[model samples]
Target: MDGLGFTVDQMAEAERRGRLFGLAGDVLQWSGPPIHTVQSAADELGLSAEEVARVWALLGLTVTGPDVAALSQADVDALATWVALKAVVGQDGAYGLLRVVGTAMARLAEAESTMIRAGMPDIQMTHTHDELATAQAYRAIAEFVPGSGT
Candidate 1:
């Protein structure tokens, strides 16, 4: 599957990298598999679908349709946090805080990824594209980073 100026080999390499990195998802505290749809998450959290979508959009996430199972446990926790904050600060205040936090977190993630990529060569000096080596390097790096407790 080649598109967007990426040759088939490039796409294949990306897929390999993604598969290797996916093994580090738990260590990285990345979201788990999708466990809820937008409507389900809203219903479980005692929120309207629109409210959930709005919060997601404010956090720089794509707002999926009501029936799409695009939300994970981490996503649900975030929505729950939004609900709690909204109760204390009202919707607008919660939105403002979410916007600030989201932007900051996004920037931090970009910086971290850049740093990690820069360090990967030293981390796995011999087997650059070896999946197991790459995954191990990622897990080691993630272990050193602080957890977000999401």
Candidate 2:
């Protein structure tokens, strides 16, 4: 029962229960000031609607709005964290990070299976030597620009 050790069964159960976010519960406790709208929340902290959407999906929450006008602050903060992590992946261009995020996300059971989905066309094209370096650059911009709060 040590804080750091979990049996495979325990980990599997956690994954089944969508407890990946709760794994970081100490850091994720609701200690910040309240936020009411998604856009304002994103604006206050610097995030994008797309980033927010992905985070909400990860946290077992759903956003129901036609636009930025209908978003909650809590959702925004969580989205910010997701954006940060995603930004890191893009910055490094290390597929390992992408795999880690995808694995963690898989445990959350929130999003679709990324492996089944295709990689970015740019990545695919570059992977085929169509434009490899540009593929990395394209990935960095597409993912980080929205997530980095820039």
Evaluate residue 47 in candidate 2 and report its C-alpha lDDT on the 0 to 100 scale.
Answer: 63
Stretches of candidate 2 exceeding 4 Å from the true structure: 1-34, 66-75, 91-150
lDDT of 1 by residue, 1-150 (tens): 222243566446546755533345333554766778889999999988888888888888784577878799888997897798799999789889989988987888788778877767634535465655665676677765656432
User: In candidate 2, what are the lDDT values of residues 1-150, reduced to their tens digit?
Assistant: 125454666556545765432232212233333334555655666766554554455444455563534444554555556557666666344334544655674564323224212544433332455343443434343343233231
Runs of candidate 1 exceeding 4 Å displacement = 1-21, 31-33, 63-66, 122-127, 145-150
TM-score per prediction, in order, is: 0.67, 0.30
Backbone clashes under 3 angstroms, per model: 0, 2
Please list the Cα RMSD from the true structure of every candidate, rounded to 1 decimal place. 7.8, 16.9
> What lDDT does each candidate get?
0.71, 0.45
Model 2 deviation from native, Cα RMSD in Å: 16.9
Q: State the lDDT at 57 in candidate 1.
A: 81
